[model samples]
Target: MSGPELRTERLVLRRWRDADRVPFAELNADPRVTEHFRSPLSRERSDALVDRIEAGFEEYGFGLWAVEVAGSGEFVGFTGLAVPSFEPPWGRSVEIGWRLAAHAWGHGYATEAATAALDHGFDVAGLPSVVSFTARTNVRSLAVMRRLGMTYDPADDFDHPVLPPGHRLRPHVVYRLTAADWRARRTG
Candidate 1:
């Protein structure tokens, strides 16, 4: 509870906990869950990722939040804001994203969690905008971005710098949503 906590109708987004590591690791190792990534992660790498996420929360007061179901308290996955390590046209900026287990998909959990995350970015963080990007082939995430009312600009497309050129996951598309736009969407 040292960090920010966000809630939606059916979800609670809060700080990482030790109990979340095993599920988080399983999520990272799932091929269906990591379809957009270069490859599945080893448990060591996954635990390291959890460490980084916790560090981000400690440093930024905001980071990829560990999401849970409201009543069941099941650790679904993560959804929230982070500063992308790689530089793109946007420079250093916060991005909203989500990653849930395959069992948690098709239930609008990602969208529900992401909606709250965007609200936090615009309202709590007072950020002008939040961005999200993924491989062009990632239709599910693209749909979630659209559901969050984020817009796509073809010109903003860029090959993921972390991915080698010509890599299958290199081609990526960018989506953006501004504070003003989020406000409008919330009201209108």
Candidate 2:
């Protein structure tokens, strides 16, 4: 689907491109980038993931966007909205997420892109709430969630249903932002 493009002060969140495939594969394969994932994706698997992301945009009008640096147009990574493929303890919900090249880390890109995505999900899509989750140990993502004003409750933690039992990344923490909360944060 030709999804809407979102612009931030330093990033552009847009649909994937043919040129994005190679670097995206590289990013997906980077051990640092994939540390939280099950494993680094093979080239074929990365391409397949891009295909699925595009299909998701087709079906939902929203999906993980290919992020690029604003002026340089350098492909960094992605940040956007998605529906979790597996059911979580909180039940079905649209999620906000991001992943950036290691070089893109510590620059506030994730939080900035994610803020725009949240605006779309809550303001444009009229979703009542959006959720985000990560391995309990992923402090970077957890901090981004807080920066975006998503509140976490320890009670919401759960083992990722897709992960094997006892997997280190199995235990996950969930954070959520309601439309009302988002509006308040924006105006207040």
Regions of candidate 2 where Cα sits further than 4 Å from its true position: none
Native-structure RMSD, model 1: 0.9
Candidate 1 clashes between residue pairs 3 or more apart in a chain or in different chains: none
At residue 109, candidate 1 shows an lDDT of 97
18-38 in candidate 1: lDDT tens per residue? 999999999999999999999
**Which candidate's TM-score is highest?**
2
Error of 2 at 95 (Å): 0.6
TM-score to true structure, per model: 0.97, 0.98
- For residue 121, give model 1's deviation from the true position in Å: 1.3
Give per-model CA RMSD: 0.9, 0.8
Query: How many residue pairs of model 2 clash at the backbone?
Result: 0
